[model samples]
Target: MRYISTRGKAPALGFEDVLLTGLATDGGLYVPESLPHFSLEEIRSWRGLSYSELAFKVMYPFVEDAVPADDFRSMLDDTYQVFAHDAVAPLVQLDTNEWVMELFRGPTLAFKDFALQLLGRLLDYVLEKRNQHVVIMGATSGDTGSAAIEGCRKCKHVDIFILHPHERVSEVQRRQMTTVTGDNIHNIAIRGNFDDCQRMVKASFGDQSFLGGKTQLAAVNSINWARIMAQIVYYFHASLALGGPDRSMAFSVPTGNFGDIFAGYLARQMGLPISQLVIATNRNDILHRFLSGNRYEQHQLEHTISPSMDIMVSSNFERLLFDLLGRNGDEVRSLLEEAQSGPVSIEDYRWKHMRKLFDSAAIDDDTTCAMIREIFEHNEYLLDPHTAIGVKAARLCRRDKAVPMITLGTAHPAKFPDAVARSGVVSQPSLPKHLSDLFEREERFTVLDHDLKTVQQFMAEHWKHA
Candidate 1:
């Protein structure tokens, strides 16, 4: 399967190259040249497969040409073996037709582990075969940093660097990234918001000359096609669990970067029978604003209980817009160029087309806390701040009450204890046994100013290219 840039200027690439190249040279995200469609019978046949087996079935078409079939299957096995749960992504029923897909059973305790764990193995395999060394630079609002660090710390051919906004991330989130001790893993606390860190990562991808033209820069962020590809599997997993393909389902995803929900959008493209896709957001709700009002504008980034969704700009929204605009790269390029200065609105027909598939809501901190408390009191279930937003949005924005709704449980509640406690829960959630001593671990990280040049220079000086 060939991958093409959303902007349509970059040369088409196969899976391996797309995995390595996070952002296109023309400032676009990579998407499959054409999605592989599964028929209803094909989708129904995957009902009882194991998580790894389901993953192989869903993702084989994308990587078949790049990775040997046996090797890819083994890699999938190895990647999921580290997850703490047997089901990998188990489903918990909340109401008659509502469910929560638990996705935080992985090593790092976040939904990102579903993709990053596989990404680390894939990068190691590809780089080892090619005899190449690379540096992975990613920006995480909270969870991605720790997940990426844990995923790639053992990789022999890669050096990983993750940046998060200083003092913005939760204690557990920051400690999760900083506590991991590895010479190859570097954590930087930038003196700005998540967008500043993300922009730096994107800029570094656009120009890698700072690496002295020796080591290639890789990405662990959702911009990488592999991350999105791996994420698409879980959508299928959750849907099949709820009697999918035979019946339609709905998903409400708490999104900041837009990659996770975009994966759901892809699942529908691959014939998952999704009735509706809900865009759930916190105060930093540029995506919610766009889907609700068609006003795609930037606002000041707000620090909320859900730090992961504290993003002013949604990077992966461009990928969806590219499709909504009928894959017209030139038009996407022009619109994005205008958007850099301020907000840009789409044509009425295009907006209507998007509205048909998506509904969105922006919940505030009060509502998020209320939802968490209410769910806990009524159902005796705990939800993290991000997932609380999702559950709230799913209840508020769901078009049909009869259709089954699944809210993507993006992270474990222990990761954000402050939010959990603030919701009036008497007992604070504790980290799992493996991470019980997270606070006791000696933390090591560098505090950097929010300057791209300085960040690039640090990468150049520290990266050990062979």
Candidate 2:
């Protein structure tokens, strides 16, 4: 279960090391050297297992060598106990063969809670054993900041800092991160876009001397292999619930950072019998452009109603390119380096191979609002802006009618009230009881300029050790 950097320069690491050391020194994401494939019988035997039990079975192989079996099982149990839904990740049918996987039942009301909840526990366990403390810095467009802060707030061994673009995130999204009062949890609203905040996090990962070199840096973002590993379980869970490995399933994922759909790609690689993987994007559609047109180019990041998907640069796309290029790290490095100046095109053969398994559609904000209204009128299902893009893409880009298509419901609609309002729906969605007082709570966060050095200094001054 060793992890290798996509750029071929960093040393191979075990699960724990990869969990802590995100964004390899060579500026590549880490991926498992080899994936564990499940036999058809193995996949069938998982039917009727509890969500926690199923997660343990799917993820144990990756961490079995690194974590004691009992401890890992206990952590999985504790991590999922907080989800609001009994099924953890439940499936609700929208049409004959169309379904939505509800992933927002977690504490933060977003799909990120599925991974961040587990990551926080894992970090605490590992750090406690080694008697070490690390700084956890992450960038979120909206949901990840709240989910990451909620997950890691109680961890004594870490100081968690999250940065989101000021005035870019929704009111619910911003308050969810800022309202939580914990000495270890710090939120920063940067005067830039999500990509700018993300760039700062990556830059800090590359050089941690700003932390005085005594404390190591950790990541709660999808760059951490643990986040991706935890996400792979839900794909298996959803498929098995709806007849999987025996029958093919298709997934439509609304993704910005590219980590969530990359998890689906990994599931198919692990013998899950997936027929198609659809990339659903908002106005910022770099991934859509790449898969549909072979044009991997960056454009100005657009602020859409779906703020979480308002990202021009997709970081996890590199991991997929690393595989599509036959695991040739040097070629991946060369392609990405070339991408800095302008668009980079893949060879026709590689592009065709990718098209065989992947399809994409870019939905605009108007289409997203219309789909929300349409779904409500037809099925009485309320979809958030992000998930609406996924449903629309699944309908437009689906290659087959018989296969069961599942769109990943990425967030609760209440998180983006403005988008929900634009749909002309009479009843506005309300926050769940746990977060009902989100607006009333006093928020504590620092508004910082987009300068990297100033941001770094702020972190240094307020860090737990300092």
- Model 2, global lDDT: 0.93
- What is the alpha-carbon RMSD of candidate 2 to the true structure? 0.8
Candidate 1 contains a number of clashing pairs equal to 0
Off by over 4 Å in 1: none
Q: How would you encode candidate 1's per-residue C-alpha lDDT over 1-466 as one tens digit per residue?
A: 8888889899999998988888999999999989999999999998899999999999999999999999999999999999999999999999999999999999989999999999999999999999988999999999999999988999999999999999999999999999898789889999999999999999999888898778888999999989999999998998888888788999999999999999999999998899899999999988888888888889888999999999987888889989998999999999988988998899999999999989999999999999999999999899999999999999999999888999999999999998999999745898899999988899999999999999988888887663
Cα miss at 377, model 1 (Å)? 0.5
lDDT of 1 at 69: 92
Clashes of each: 0, 0
Q: Which residue pairs in candidate 2 have backbone atoms (N, alpha carbon, C) closer than 3 angstroms, thus clashing?
A: none
List the global CA lDDT of all models.
0.93, 0.93
Error of 1 at 195 (Å): 0.4
Q: State candidate 2's TM-score.
A: 0.99
